[model samples]
Target: MLVTAFAANKTPPPSPTTTVNHPETRQIHLKPINRRRILTSLAATITPFFAPRLEVNYEESNLVTATFLPSADARGLFQMPPPRLSNRYFLVRAGESEYESMGIINTNPVAKTSMDNGLSKIGKIQTVKAALKLKEMGACDNNCWIWPSITQRAYQAAEIIAAINVVNRSNVVPEYSFLDARGLGAYEGRPLQSVSEIYASDVVSQNVKPPPISDGTPNESVADVFVRVTQLMSILETQYSEDTVIIVSPDSDNLTILQAGLVGLDLRRHSELYFEPGEVRYFDPSSIPKYKQPASALYKCLNPPSCT
Candidate 1:
């Protein structure tokens, strides 16, 4: 009678497991808990996406004077408008230098140019490997240009890259303060770790310009660096197209910040894009993550297709 009553009950039995069968194959059983575990595992593996942060400062802003702009859509872009670029761009952080090996910080324009502060032996080898990689990638198959910082280590790396690739020696143009390492003010000649304080502040505000020295050394903020890098980008995008351009920097900060600006990232968090010494990254505008289109006032159009 008890079994008869159980059978008459309308309640359905809970499924302990479900069997999935492949045609002419073995049947695999999956428990409900197993399904939940699989879903949880997938969720753990997936990385959550974060929207680009825009922190604008009108005081440091300047107008972009270029007449021609690249055709890229500028919606949601910050610092500068979406660049119209036909040229392939590469960012190369200079190889380790003598000063770097010694754990010294040197951004003084005069002192950094000295030969002793130039690329160490390992640095030269690293630069040569990078050039070979570029050759393998056929980056210099056409007109290639290497724009390097005036700092000796970066210039040396540029020369090495030029020698190994198809680019001519003359094409290795030396850029001035624009590509220089971030200035650490009184922290100059201090230990490399001392600059962490400045970066900590940069995380708080992009407008935090470092105090200046009496000797005329640069004491700049991340925004100050952005201003110069934006100017450089204006020139490059305006003058070159259908060419390969390699920009070499003596330190990671310049290239990282430049990349941050290039991708319309918040300049204050530029350190998130830091490059290892001798690291090389190819820049592609189409591959960047997109955000909701922002108003044109969000950025200064460095080189706009139409400023209207």
Candidate 2:
């Protein structure tokens, strides 16, 4: 019953959860700017789905980020439908931005350095959590492919698949990449000199535009990211059709693709998906007619479930 996707002859109920929201805080002046970056695009895009004559600001709406609204991602599916849920690709956003202090550039120097201090500690902890979640969600330990961005932050991904196959040790092999740079130039890895050069909001106070993220070329937009991700899924279906490929990538890169994907699908709602520290998501090919598939919400460490 816990894993079922549909209700009995009626619309499924809205999400019910026990997590509590902390009191809203404006303690940091920089906070609102982060919300504005993505929400602005969402609001403007949603207007087209409403009555043809509707208008919206998208900049300041609380409802723009309704996570538990089961139909939240539905509206996005109407315009550009999500890709078929291929069994081979399991997209994952690596644990929290633990490297916020390291300034985002994964140049040769940084790449050679291991994640240090608290980020290293938290990164491993989150990887283990995600490992446990994926197994419980029906993933088999053998023949898994761990794909991660060719950045230092991706060290967490190696640890993740390792945790997934603790007993066998050789169950999965990891491959790091910059989006298949040689052939797939459709989207390129960000080449930032410093973290400040990465996102518009990252250096908003500087009053400068974000430089081209790829060899000084124009940075890819959210829509571009979505297209590239879908393309990768298709390629993997051909390459690893019999195995699973779990992706580990950055937040903005992965989330932007997801947020844009929800809009492309166009179901019925306009909301930002919530991805927290140690978050893991699963999409099963078996769940065809995916617009109706429920979001994975199985939580652990509550009351223990007895072993069979």
Candidate 3:
């Protein structure tokens, strides 16, 4: 009865009289089941999935319990852990570009390199004034670096700054992409007045990306640019200490966004901290008000899905 019940679960066997498929179908050999080994195999497979999870939870509890600050209870109160900046940062907005004088937006790399679209004559004068201002402030009295966007206008400004500040050409490092102007996506080459639409979207959320271009130019969100800027900050903090860094940008957006992050302002409102062409500001982290730190928590990402 037991054998009949066990065999009932498998495919029906051919009758003893049936010889048609006997030569065609090959018999599969069956090994006797080892209950202990099977159980051991399952334990090996399943234990790992839960064991590490349990171990991670235990470790995280010990690591984060005393250190983690919940945002809910800390409302309206200033929190510590300010941005770790070991260098003096002088944020400079490069002088007006030829495109700006023409009332156009030209963020395309090829066009930016062209003299027709690069810095205007007026821009060169503005850059010289900004550079002279830096020299007057004694910004490069100690070790200093002149960092600029790869855009021709910014590079021009950086050269002027290096000359005025007596910094070496090697120290005038041109940032290839991160410090470049915020690409306006499909709005590229459009009238400068069209930028209001981009800022309108930015006022709503930092994650809003501009419409993508057909030429494979990426439309970046404020968050995307923020990530790049954050990476740049990390690199600068790690590589240099107690040095002066002059960060030059082709447009106001990059400098404003960087200032917003450094001062703990909501990134969505970065446009509020605008930088005019040829504007120069010395970034001092210690000067940030306590109110800015506490207000940052209002937009804090505490829970999942609601974070972005």
**Ranking of all candidate structures by their TM-score, best first:** 3, 1, 2
What are the per-residue Cα lDDT tens digits for candidate 3 across 74-184? 332212123366788999999989889998877766565677656788888888999999988889988699889888899999999999888999998889888867877
Which pairs clash in model 1?
69-304, 70-84, 76-294
TM-score of 3: 0.68
Q: Select the stronger candidate by TM-score from 1 and 2.
A: 1
Tens digits of lDDT, candidate 2, 49-123? 553333445777645532332233452332233345435455565564434434333322233224531235666
Regions more than 4 Å wrong, model 1: 1-79, 286-308
Instruction: Report the C-alpha lDDT of model 1 over 150-262, residue by residue, as the tens digit.
Output: 89999989988888886888888899868888877877778888778888887767778666786657888887888788788877876777888999999888887787777
**Cα-lDDT of candidate 2:** 0.44
Q: Candidate 2 vs candidate 3: which has greater TM-score?
A: 3
TM-score of each: 0.67, 0.45, 0.68
Ranking by lDDT: 3, 1, 2
Report clash pairs, candidate 3: none
TM-score of 1: 0.67
Candidate 2 Cα outliers beyond 4 Å, as residue runs: 1-83, 86-89, 101-119, 141-143, 167-218, 255-263, 266-271, 284-308
Candidate 1: Cα lDDT at 50:
26
* lDDT for predicted candidate 1 compared with the true structure: 0.74
